[model samples]
Target: GAGVSQSPSNKVTEKGKDVELRCDPISGHTALYWYRQRLGQGLEFLIYFQGNSAPDKSGLPSDRFSAERTGESVSTLTIQRTQQEDSAVYLCASSEWTGRNQPQHFGDGTRLSIL
Candidate 1:
């Protein structure tokens, strides 16, 4: 892909349903990240993947949230038993990390609505 791409853009779901959001990162990028933003809240880091090292999934809110990355390619975030509090923008970003500081290029995001 040319840039980070997120799917659906808008999702409306009843409470307790499951949703899967997808992300396609920029080609050749080695790092991928997922973030969640609620209304008026800052970006909440959900997970990060770099190369073959361990994925950082520490920020996931609960057992209902999980994600996976295939090498340095596509990634998917799944939220099961969604609740009203789950309504937010799910953003994905990719960066080519060299040493320490590499700015991530972000996707617009999947707007999940759990009513």
Candidate 2:
């Protein structure tokens, strides 16, 4: 795809289950980011990967959430022991660079529901 692509657009899982969300960034884009949006809420930054630099995971809400990007290609966001509060749309975005002024293009997002 020419833009960021995320799989499993909708997921339903029980509380305490673990889920893995995938994101494939646009080719040649050097910066990738993960964000989550709860119902009626704004997007929340989750993690970021830029080239070979160490990923900035400061946005992750807790240790149960983590993400990794191999080079500037695919990235995955894993959430362990899912809770009802974890239900949201997980969005992926990529940009040509990580500079403050760089614009990012976003994916449709994966909607996760915890039963």
Q: Could you say which candidate leads in TM-score? A: 2
Q: Candidate 2 on 1-115: residue-level lDDT in tens? A: 8778999899999999999999999999999999999999999999999899999998999999999888889999999999999999999999999998999999999999999
Candidate no. 1 TM-score: 0.95
TM-score of each: 0.95, 0.97
Instruction: Show where candidate 1 strays beyond 4 Å.
Output: none
The residue pairs in collision within model 1 are: none
- Model 1 vs truth, CA RMSD: 1.1
Per-prediction tally of clashes = 0, 0
Q: Model 1, range 1-115, lDDT digits (tens) per residue?
A: 5789999899999999999999999998899999999999999999999988898989999999999999989999999999999999999999997346788999999999999
Best by lDDT: 2
Candidate 2 displacement at residue 29 in angstroms = 0.5
lDDT scores of the candidates, listed in order? 0.92, 0.95
State in Å the error of residue 78, model 2.
0.2
